[model samples]
Target: MTQDELKRLVGQAAADYVKQHVPEGSVIGVGTGSTANCFIDAIAADRARYRGAVSSSEASTERLRGHGIEVFDLNQIDSLPVYVDGADEINALGHMVKGGGGALTREKIVASVAMTFVCVVDASKRVPVLGLFPLPVEVIPMAQASVARALTAMGGTPQARVRADGSPYVTDNGCTILDVRGLQILDPVAFETSVNQIPGVVTVGLFAQRGADLCLMGTTAGVEMTDYRN
Candidate 1:
């Protein structure tokens, strides 16, 4: 199957899994990115199964709403049982590199509150280690270059994210992203902690600390379920 076909399969699998597992009226946490968009489209079929969703990005929010799924504010909701999203790269340990959509901070926040985090991805996304994909670091606008310098000292190539128009790409939180490349993250948890300590860094894209509870990886055969929580 093609990449988009694989993503659609995994997205449907995620929706099926949640509809069968999550409570009838529970609220959910949704994530960002293209794969996550597939999940959003999939979940629309069972929109009434859950109350609504707390979205990680405005793009996801709009997509969710377009699907007729009610999008709720995180502050208004106390508990999120399931957070379903996609990863840029994931390993056997379930560590992931996300935020390609510039929604890292909110994704972290929503995922933090969820009881379970499910990552949906195509098979190509699986990797031996994190960091093959450029790790995105959301930083305050004024500190963008400074944080890039700090990332450089850490032995990574940092580039400020820009739009198609060559303007700076501002995140939903009004921050800019630095896409750092070339550092092989052998220890994702430690690296996450260390990068978060940078003054201008709002949040790193590493999802190690609250990694996937499970992953629905779409291969040519089918959607293969991997349970990390086990």
Candidate 2:
């Protein structure tokens, strides 16, 4: 199957998983991106089964609302049963590099409050290490240069993310993204913590500190589920 088909397969599987695991009338957390968009469409068939959703990005929020699913603000919701999202890349340890679409900050925030993070991705996203994909780091616009310097000191190439039109890619939080490359994140937790301490850095796209609790990997064969907590 093609990659898009694989994404759809996992998306359906995630919707099924949610129905089985999350209780009725519970508000779940939704993620951003194409794969996550597929999940939104699949889950829409059973929209009434859940109370509503807390979306990770404005795009996802619009999509959720378009499907007649109510979207709730994070502050209004205390906890989430599950956060279903896609990962740019994932390792055996469930570590992920997200935010290719520039929603890292919000995605991380929503994931933090969830009881379980259900990462849905295609087989190609599975990797032996976590740094192959450019690590997206959200930073204040004025501090972009300083943050880049700090990232360079850490032995990586930090390039300011830009759009097709050549303008800077601004995130939902109104900050710019620095896509860092060339560092093998052997210790994700430490790497995440250290980068977060850098001044002007809002948050890195590393999901190691609170990585995925479960991963639904889509393959040509079918969806493979792994519970990291186990």
Candidate 3:
């Protein structure tokens, strides 16, 4: 199957998993990105099953609302049972590199409040370690240079993200992103902690501390489920 097809497959599988595990009328946390968009499309078929959703990005919020799924503010909701999202790269241990679409901070916040996080991805996204994909670091606009220097000191190439027109790419939070390349993350949890401690760093794209509780990985064979919590 094509990559798009694989994404749709896992998307449906995630919707099914949520249907089975999450109780009716419960609010769920939704994430951003292409794969997560597929999940939104699939879950739309059962929109009534969910009370609403707390979205990680404005794009996802618009998509969810487009599907007739009510998008709720995180502050208005007390509990989120399930958070479904996608990853850029995921290791054997289930830690992931996300934020390729520049929604890392909000994604982390929504995922943190959820009882379970279900990551959906294609087989190509699976990796032995977490750093093959450039690690995205969201930084305050004024402190971009300082953060880049700090990241360089840590042995990686930091490039400020840009738009198609060559202007700086600003995130939904009005922060800029520095996509750091050329570092192999052997220890994701430790790497996440250290990067987060960097001044002006809003949040690293490393989803280690609150990584996937379970992953629905799409392969040529079908959707293969891995329970990280187990």
Candidate 4:
């Protein structure tokens, strides 16, 4: 099957998993990117079953609203039973390199509140170790250079993310993204915490601190569900 087909299969699996597990009237935390978009489309059929969604990115929020699903502000929601998103890379330990779309800050925030985080991705995204994909780090615009230097000192090459127009890409939070490459991350939690301590850094792409509780990996055979907590 094509990669897109595989992504769609896992997206549907994630939707089905949410429907079967999350209780009725619960607010879901939705994430960004193409795979998450596929999941949003799949879940549209079951929209009425849940209260609404707390979206991690403006793009996902717009998509959810387009489907006539109400999106509640995260600040207002007391409980978020489930959060679904895609990963750029995921290790066996469930740590992820996310924010390829530059939504790390909000994704982390939404995931923090969710009781269950369900990561949906195609099998190609599964990696023995994270960091092959350049890890995204959001930073304050003025501190971009400073943060880049700090990231470089950490043994990675940090490049400022730019748009197709050759202009700096700005995130939803009015920050910039530094795509850091190099370095095989063997220790996820420690690396995550260390990067987060940089003065200008908003948030690193690492999701290890509160990694995926479950992962739905799509392959030609079928979707393989792994509960990381086990």
The count of backbone overlaps in candidate 3 is 0
lDDT at 148 for candidate 1?
90
Writing each residue's lDDT as its tens digit, candidate 1 over 122-230 gives 9999999888999999999999888999999999999999999999999988989999999999999999999999998999999999999999999988989999988
> Clashing residue pairs, candidate 4?
none
Candidate 2 wrong stretches, greater than 4 Å: none
Q: Mind giving the per-residue lDDT tens digits that candidate 2 earns over 58-169? A: 9999999999999999999989999999999999999999989899999999999999999999999999988999999999999999999999999899999999999989
lDDT of 3: 0.96
**Which is the better candidate, 1 or 2, if ranked by TM-score?**
2
Evaluate residue 185 in candidate 4 and report its C-alpha lDDT on the 0 to 100 scale.
Answer: 93
TM-score of each: 0.98, 0.99, 0.99, 0.99
Question: Any idea what lDDT model 1 has?
Answer: 0.93
Error of 1 at 175 (Å): 0.5
Q: Could you give candidate 3's per-residue lDDT for residues 125-226 as a string of tens digits?
A: 999987889999999999999999999999899999999999999999999999999989998999999999999999999999999999999999999999
Q: Which stretches of candidate 1 lie above 4 Å from their native place?
A: none
Off by over 4 Å in 4: none
